[model samples]
Target: MEKIAPVRLSVLGHPQRLAVFRLLMRRFPDRIPATELAQALNVKPNTLSNYVSALMQVGLLTQERIGTSLRYGIDMQSARETFDYLLLDCCRGRPELCAPTSNFDLNNKASKKYNVLFLCTGNSARSIFAEAILRQEAGDRFNAYSAGTTPRAGLNPFALEVLQQKGHDISVLRAKNVSEFQAESAPQFDFVFTVCNQAANEDCPAWAGQPVSAHWGMPDPVKAEGTDAQKSLAFQQTYGALRNRIRVFASLPLGSLDRISLQSTLDDIGQLENGVSA
Candidate 1:
């Protein structure tokens, strides 16, 4: 049996500390100083000093002395802890609320990894982006595929370009429609994500396999009409968002994750918008 997530996760006990946490998570782990945190909070330096003192006292804040100032950030491990706590409440009286690891044994034989499918309206932009990132980040753990509800016969040239620019190889990529994978002998999907806002909103075919399905809504980057740089930037944002979500899904303990717990977490993944929303 899994232990319940800790209840001390809320920083709301001190609004200032909560403010400090938001400031730190936004700036540092990547180091903003005390003044930066105060400026972000729009509080006076002296007032912030007191708040910082209290926050640092708790494990939520970490501080480092620079030559002339102190930098603080929301301790990420603590933030992850708070997320776990939020999940626990969802599990009350129903352990399925907070998905736990499965107990299946596959010690000798090679176990099958999960299958993920990403869907889009056109397959030219967003689907391509999601497919590449998921493959790069989670391919070893999950087999990732992308298809368009209405196919676009070829890959998005810019999608290919931006992916390569970001260090992903796309020499063998191509575009296809959702129908291609819907045939009688289709591979069973363990999960599916729709990236296009329109397709995500539409009633998708009832995936007969009934794997976990969710939407990670994102605006169409291919809609951007302007210079190459502007279009490239749009693709970059799309790529980053997909990459972040794929990292989270891949991080889940699928090998031991229980179905109830997995389904609940997958549902929570629906609350995610773009990448960081969850």
Candidate 2:
């Protein structure tokens, strides 16, 4: 732990390297393509390659080829170990110092209600599932909204089916254009999340409120292939994935968390691999 922790810290010591790591953390579980990562960091491809290599050498990042381009994602196992080392070994019995502190001024009205917006490319499946799940699970605590970058003609039938099976009211669910929420008349969002890779990568509309944003990208169940039962199973899995995430989000002590800590928690939530884990 001692050796690995210091090495990880040294690699992240460089400003550009740290920025790269932070961006990956915010987009956890969604591997960003090489070109997109470079553009997002405003770093040259060659330089970014070296930075990525440094992180990979220390086991802080993982790389894979999705088609023709290389994609990068955080190595969650390494990250957890590094964090555990810091909290367990460095705290010297003063664990309170490591705990997240409250910043009441950031979200002072968390005790009341929070408006959350979930986004995706089609708004027909993943985003719809997220909206419905949060509404059903935490309706009193959060107002759930969803929209698409380029909405489809209607909601995905399988999504509606799964929601109906789960006893959710599907009457209010529809594929909405993101512009609807960007309008001056829309409610001020406290949290904005992109639930699919396409929406997360796209240039999104500017929200009126300075909402905390994160990428919680998941596989699109709508694109599932095979028999009808298989396709329906995909939708059910998507619903389960969103439900697990929403439940964890709803259970957070929002009233006590600072903005930074809240952001971290949201990012960690994104690291959930599927419908499993906290």
Candidate 3:
């Protein structure tokens, strides 16, 4: 085991190999296809294959055939073993000496507040719902903001109705372009989420501070078919979905998770069923 630890460490010593490992860690439990991994890392397929092969050889990664293409994910047990060996054995059992320099103790009631932005294509419905819900849920701990790629002139009436029905204040809600938040004077966001498929795929402007991002895509309530009653029902369901996800998000123990683990948790939160809370 002692001999193997160095081999594992050496494999991750290279810059590109380390990047591959970290990316897989952040996307844990969701195996990424080779093509997607290559494009994300901006590395040639041939070159990435070699790096992937090395990590797999060291038991740090697992691969499976998803149809014709190969998908890769981190082997959590193996990664844990590698980390344990480094801290418990190689560091002479003094784990305290190996602690990360930066502190991650973000208390929910602490003065340290995080800026979060929720995005959709129109800024009229889903993103607005998220901003209001998160504000209602954890306003003191998080500063929630919402914006859109190509924003509408005003807020969706049904969206506003549903929010107001739920006792959320709607007077301050207004549609804003994503560019407004991208300005230099804009608050540095700690997290950003895309609540619609279109906004998730759009080429968004580079944000200041490079916030952690995830896609929480849900149906556009504004596009719901049928009568006004049915349309309002759609908005109501969207509200429940966003609230469900936000509740779990607000409950997260941010102090306990490193950046990679936090990102993985955020991704998993996105996969939560519409009416379910995790």
Model 2, residue 196: C-alpha shift (Å): 0.2
Tens-digit lDDT track of model 3 for 129-204:
9999999999988999999999999999999999989999999899999988888799878789988765764555
Per-residue C-alpha lDDT of model 2 across residues 109-210, encoded as one tens digit per residue? 645778899999999999999999999999998999999999999999888889899999999998999999988899888889999876775545556646
TM-scores of the candidates are 0.57, 0.69, 0.64
Between candidates 1 and 3, which one is better according to TM-score? 3
Backbone clashes for every candidate come to 7, 0, 0
Instruction: Report how far off residue 184 is in candidate 2 (Å).
Output: 1.0
Return whichever of 2 and 3 wins on TM-score: 2
**Candidate 1: 10-residue stretch with minimal lDDT:** 1-10
Q: Which window of 10 residues has the lowest lDDT sum in candidate 3?
A: 101-110
Model 1 residue 140 CA deviation in Å: 1.6
lDDT (Cα, tens digit) per residue for candidate 1, span 165-264: 8787787567887887788888767777777545653445667546666666677888888999999888888888778777887898775776667766
Instruction: Give per-model CA RMSD.
Output: 12.0, 7.2, 6.1
Q: How many backbone clashes does candidate 3 have?
A: 0
Model 3 bad stretches (over 4 Å): 1-111, 275-278
Candidate 1 vs candidate 2: the lDDT winner is 2
Clashing pairs in 2: none
